[model samples]
Target chain A: MKEIMAIVRMKKTGATKKALVATGVAGFTAVKVIGRGKLVTDTDELEKCREKLLALGLDEVSDAGDTETLVTSFLDGSRFFPRRLFTILAHDEDVPRIIEAITTANRTDYGIGDGTIFVLPVADAVRVRTGEAGEAAIW
Target chain B: MLLIRAIVRPEKKDEVLAGLSEAGFNAATMVDVVGRGKQKGIKIGGMVYDEIPKILILVVIPDGEKEKVVKVILSTARSRNEGAFGDGKIFVSPVEEAYTISKNALGL
Candidate 1:
């Protein structure tokens, strides 16, 4: 068994769910998560701010005194963004299909925040109701 | 790396998290879930509450740190000194790889 986890944009959740259901996924767990990517600085945005500072006659942005201020102003304050985390368990054969469905649904024109898919190994699964185990329980 | 998933009593969530943090394993994901264990559910005065609320805590760490992490959870998540049913259960699985979404770098 495989545990397929996808961290996607909050707005794309509906589309992702529909796509999963369409692919015949029996069930999945969705959690509201606040997370941020590792990129703390966006070079393009920084460059834009640099230009704005130069326009304002503040050429000391490169100096240590104003560096902190410049960086702080560029930051929106909240480092973490809201996201939806979907955890899906499936047979090995279904892993590829599920991943494809999620990607197709969450992909956007910008292509950066579509989200990430992680495949992990699941040693076993059990159905509490019937005491079923392994593949029997998953189906 | 390994992913340690512990389905613990909702009330004990804070203790477990604190234990982990103090032990230097601060990164974890928590999800509220409902399920039953070996004892099944609980029986009340006249009704059977099969679905019990639980907090599933997920922590990914280096494989060598599994023992330390699990020990922390076990000590803190117990209901009582002697421990009892419904305290919770833990599952450790292998994580092939991890990626940081923003950095687009491999391995966490």
Candidate 2:
């Protein structure tokens, strides 16, 4: 069995979760992160991004100010790009297809509009609530 | 099932997401990533670029979804005006089996 993880970018927040669920992914975990990409070119683009984020109340500079409200709630931040981790347990043969799906979901020719895919061997997995074990049995 | 992984140009993330969403596959995960490919990150003068921000997108999909997903990704990543360079690559592998421990949902 295997486990797959992806770092995807969505136009808006929550798209990743929705897309993954639609693909019939059994279960996955997501984590919020911060990253910078090559997309930001000049002051115009940066200003536009900052303005858009501020209007959405996603821009946070102060510790307990406008952004603290969404730190955990909305996964919102002023980061160039929000980093999120998606992980799933699967069988070995399913790796390639999963990577393809993610690539399709995040590709761009211009700046940093792309996604990366990663896979790892699953030693063991268990559903804490149900006590399920093994890669196949506990995805 | 096959696991398809891609490290793409960061700007095209939305296109990738939309492509997957339109293809009836919407669920996925993302993480802030830093790495370089082919160009070995980026080049300037004689110095090597150390840190480049990228995203790692991963998915576990049925075999049938691989081709379609790849096509979508390649198309989305390719620039209409220009092409090649930082379009990135996609990696594929197999999944032995799948199941949800709590519900015992197997190989869906």
Candidate 3:
């Protein structure tokens, strides 16, 4: 067995769920999370801030000591964005289909925060009510 | 690399994270979950509360850091001096690879 984890944008969760179900995933776990990737700045906000500084007659805002602090503060608030994380357990052969379903559902024009998927090995599984173990428990 | 999934008491989540951070294993992902262990949940008066709240902390570390990381979680996630039932469980699993979504890099 393998555990497939996908971190996706909050808005795309509903579509992702439908796609996974269509691919024959019986069960999965999802939770709300806040995370970020390598890119930290919010360029749109930075542009607005820059325009404001320029209107105030500070053309050299990039070299201004205080404006540097202003830019950093504006970027800090956007460092982490809301996301949804889904965890699914599946047979080895089913991994590819599941990944394809998720990716197709989540891909958007704005690429950076689309999300990520990871697969990890699962040594064992157990069903509490039936006391069943291994693959039997998962299926 | 190996990923350690530790399902611990909600109250002990912070302590565990702190312990790991102090030990230099700083990055971890946490989720709020509800589960029941071998004790089969708890009963209070007329109610049988089967879904107990838990915090699942996931940390991916190099193969060599497994012992140290697990040790930190064990000590800090324990409820009392001697430990007790429902202290939670930890599972370690192999990780094939890691990637940075923004950079599209191959590995962490």
Candidate 4:
């Protein structure tokens, strides 16, 4: 089985969800992730965003997984940056088209921001929701 | 077979996967990666940030499903705010072969 992972901006979550659901591989695991990238915001606006998100109870932990991306001109210089994690387990055969869909979804909707994606082999898989193991669970 | 590499805003990962899975390309692999585009990373004050968090999803597909997956990623990742920035990027390449190491088998 393969595990497809993606990280995107918080604002794009809704569209991302629609894209995934459309593909039959809907099961996924997600997390709120923080990042420090090249945002195009001025000092004042940056501080304002930092203050607002902090007030909203968003605490960004240091990224230990190296899962963050940086784009200088995203948003034509908008400096606010927030990210999310999306992971799925699937069979090896299903990878290519799913990736294509994901790219299409991300590109058309990203608007002003840029991000990155990579795929790695899944050594194993188990359904956390139902405890089903191996390929059966992933599929 | 073809390999599709989509560097999208990390948030779009789930929706994109859900769409591809539903389309019959049910399996894919993912990795956590960091990189920047011509935009050249974000600049705050004197410091320039070059690295961003991105999820890399790797999937091998028979020729048939390529278009479907591409379409799904495109439509979903688009935004109503056309003036904003940081939407993400995608790349596709051909695969000469595929195999499941554990199964010790060739071809999907």
The DockQ leader among the candidates is 3
TM-score of chain B of each: 0.95, 0.84, 0.94, 0.83
State how far residue A77 of model 3 sits from its true place (Å): 12
| Pairs clashing within candidate 1 | none
* Residue A20 in candidate 4, Cα distance off native in Å: 36
Query: 2 or 3: which has the higher lDDT?
Result: 3
User: How would you encode candidate 1's per-residue C-alpha lDDT over A30-85 as one tens digit per residue?
Assistant: 98875433232566855665565456645454776676576555343223456799
Tell me the lDDT of candidate 4. 0.60
Tens-digit per-residue lDDT, A1-139, candidate 2: 7677555554522666665666667878777754332223366644554455457644444554756454433322223456665777766666666655555455543323344455557677777888878764745
In model 1, where do residues sit more than 4 Å from their true spots? A9-82, A88-117, A122-139
Per-residue CA lDDT of model 3 for B1-108, tens digit only, reads 888999999999879877887787655666788999998899889888889999887777878988999899999999888999999999998887554444444454
TM-score of chain A of 3: 0.73
Q: Give the Å error, residue B52, model 1.
A: 1.3
Interface RMSD of each: 4.6, 13.3, 3.9, 14.6
Model 3, span A32-122: residue lDDT tens: 9755443335778457655664556543646577666665554443334678989999888898788778878887755556777778888
Worst 10 residues of 1 chain A by lDDT: A71-80
Q: Give the alpha carbon lDDT tens digit for every residue of B18-75 in model 2.
A: 6866676554545557777767766789987857776666556777888898888788
Q: DockQ of candidate 4?
A: 0.02
**Leading candidate by TM-score:** 3
Question: Model 2's lDDT to the true fold?
Answer: 0.60
